[model samples]
Target: MKTSNGRKLSHAALSLTVLGALLGAAPDSHALGTQGACQDNHIPVALAPGLPADQEVFARLCLPPGQTPATVQLLIHGITYSHLHWDFPDPTGHTQRYSYVSAALDAGFATLAMDRIGSGKSSHPPGATVSIDSNAYVVHQVVQALRAGQVAGPSGAVGFQKVVLVGHSYGSFTSWYEASDYRDVDGVILSGVSHTIQLTSPLRVLVPLYPAALDPAFFGQGYDLTYMTTQPGTRYGAFYAPGQADPAVVALDERTKGTVTDTEFSPFAVILARPLDIRVPVLLVNGAEDRIFCGPTLSGTVCSSAEALIAAEKPRLGAQVPCVEAFVLPGAGHDLNTILDAQQWFAVAQSWMTRRIGAGADQTPGCGP
Candidate 1:
């Protein structure tokens, strides 16, 4: 009868912009292709789909250098991408040419990348439940698995050092949840979540205002259709492409429509209540032209918590930004891997992680203006 997917206007705008703006905003467009030379630093680990179900998932571990460190940095992946997404060829999978994982390895830091669980090699958890909480548990188990030698991590640090979880989008939610779940973490990094989180109206409610053309073009042919009839979890993650859902991972978009209350959920919002309780520094990273959050450069900030983090090329509406060190990479979109020299961003990230993990300080403490 009616289309349920909302953001029809924004979707139409972004669909048109995806070709020229999203891909063209960067100066290093050529580097996005294979010609850019993707360098693999070093991530020695195996893939585990998931526990109980025994699905195949992807993960890579980087051992600490000569000296055993005391802390570890866990890199949480964003929506739709596997653990490999942020490392090499970029998390966005926009291109294999630029991989942040490669840069992290080259920088000589201990890190781990994990496939959420079901979307990758891992089997789906029972009840087909893919909630953010479930993803956090998966990350928790994965960390244990890493320590157990099922996956690898910083050597020497062992059980002594703090574990910092860096998350993006849904991945950030996992990290946010991790901060509350685990006690050993040293810090958490949130990018793309400048501030508060607001839930969108359910598809069932939005269908009346549905824009047919926008659905196929925006969500792509297969996913939009599936979501239209099959319901969300049929493919699991609707945040990005279906079937690519990391069984071990979950996003706000994953659960049943309106099942979780906004107060009950929201990674950034979760961080606020326990901001002082966390006792860890948080770094927030975002793109000046982030289409998804900012509504294709549309008015209003991508997130509600714009006050806490330091703003880069935008205005803050009295949010608590000073607490969050915000950085904006010019011209970058949601594509973490394909953005810029990919390696450079990773190098920068490595610096941040290194500083937090006792490797060193971020050469550039500030992000963008």
Candidate 2:
């Protein structure tokens, strides 16, 4: 499916052409609104890790005002961002209240947002043949095509009995290896990453990257030299926080930036020495001045609050990951969703996605004594 006017339809011609104008529109909706149905799939993953699935990943999904929400968030965006780092357009109307997809569709939830296959509008292939387990096996094939409804849109192909994932910074290391090697999500958020990383903060985020075919905002855009980005105006010192950002959202994040590959930075030290079982119900936020995981230089991990980031990340999460919440945000950095308090960290991640995976019976009050 496709329809941001590029026009190639079919998911039965977008369920009989725009499914009754995207489920009978009743328009007075404003905060980043256009009411329901926002389709633009692509899907077909696998361009690496055990290859052969062809390309595409793109995503988008949406859905809210006109229901169809049994819970779905997905998202991802990070290293040089796309899926516009969770919907941040802000064309100088002064930070559209820092949209985490308009605060997760005003908290009703059903988001998607992808583009991690070598960033935006997916499929880029040869940037050292992408990795981080091929972007966690292309987000576990878009989380089994959003739980087998096959990811279509314009009101067709919907499916989700619960899926959370979220992510950020290197898409939070591809959502901690796709929820710890595909247990198939039910909840997990992550956000600017941390299982503790700050030793020279990966050489200060790889010393302001380089080749997105030599960034003039991706000139000629045929990307090679292993993709990458960040250089011109160094996005207010590699990603805001000093003076809590804004400069027109750091020049519209160096004009819609996206790209990062050299095999996704060498597997983050063997996936942080393997041990994030990720059973579900996890949160993690960050950016309490996160100079690549808290520290302006090199000071180990302690984001200063939220009980010092869940006592420096709850003993490296895994014991069936039942309750792991952590937030921080404060004077944001590490691109905390384009700063300016970012809707106070998207209301603490949509109130922990409505008390641990929305709608009834999963209260998630674990991790206490």
Candidate 3:
């Protein structure tokens, strides 16, 4: 079946058992194991103007054992990351505690973690062809496919009556546009992002990003100069907080890092300037020490406490928003998934979802009285 934009959605899956063994994951209901059905899918999406049509978006869809879920969380990674952002495979054989995907599955929610059009296993159009707007368009199509049962799985075509967008960093920016423009999703969970930000902090990321082709990680990978990645040995400083992140996770992150396009970087001011009219339940999460958006003074958000962060963001979201919430992961940085206490925030999100949106697909997403 064709998506709302008139493009067909295509998908493929690998053997779940084989995938589990390869990633050192075991079969467990509370872990990203082989018990549940999981597939790596390539979904066709139309790109922005002047780009090729029918570009495929790569996603990993995992449903819980015994029954299909009525509600699904569509995971979008930050720049320089992949679907792994949501399901970080623990290199130490302790995968049970680290993955947000696993936690959601254990809570009876399906999860679809996807790579944006220009990153990970997805189609890499010219870097100039990718932007926050274009990425948002792709996400909207994916949401429609999920709701329409156009995304095929091992059992057959599967659809969710409710979809919640879960985004981190740049993914949160894309979610902002999608939730505002399409207003199709049931809920949104945004992390590592806020309307207020430390203006000078972005230089810490931009200064280190050279052409991905030149980075030893992407050498001979055929990326254009517009495809950007951090210099080697820079992930720890740029994305994680010292002494709060695991070194092993940082190493794995560097080894599997993704790219960001130049086009994705140029539209920040315009996007923030546009008014948002999202009418669903919106949750904002950030690391207490997020170097990009947290600071000591009022230049950016005061992430010292959750209440403070909520106060900082509430005014920016406008009175039109019905229900908005915030959480701050203490001692963590921008990359919340790989930090020491990552699961703490994951639990917070899960609990919040249950309270606001509930588990039933027919449940309307809003603030509970």
For candidate 1, what is the lDDT? 0.42
**lDDT on C-alpha atoms for all candidate structures:** 0.42, 0.72, 0.78
- Look at candidate 2 and tell me the lDDT of residue 97: 73
Query: By descending lDDT, how would the candidates be arranged?
Result: 3, 2, 1
Give one digit per residue, the lDDT tens place, for model 3 in 156-207.
7789889999999999888888988888988899899877667777686788
lDDT of 3 at 179: 88
Per-residue CA lDDT of model 1 for 74-103, tens digit only, reads 767654345544533222233333545445
Candidate 3 clashes between residue pairs 3 or more apart in a chain or in different chains: none
Better of 1 and 2 by TM-score: 1
Off by over 4 Å in 3: 1-35, 49-52, 295-300
Ranking by TM-score: 3, 1, 2
User: Residue 319 in candidate 3 has what lDDT?
Assistant: 62
Worst 10 residues of 2 by lDDT: 25-34
lDDT per residue (tens digit) for residues 19-130 in model 2: 3323332111112323345677788877656768888888778776756777788888878778856766454442347668768877888788888897867888788878
TM-scores vs. true structure, each candidate: 0.54, 0.32, 0.88
The number of clashing residue pairs in each candidate reads 45, 0, 0
The local lDDT score (0 to 100) that residue 207 gets in candidate 3 is: 82
After TM-score superposition, the amount by which residue 180's alpha carbon in candidate 3 deviates from its true location, in angstroms, is 0.1
User: Where does the lowest 10-residue lDDT sum fall in candidate 3?
Assistant: 3-12
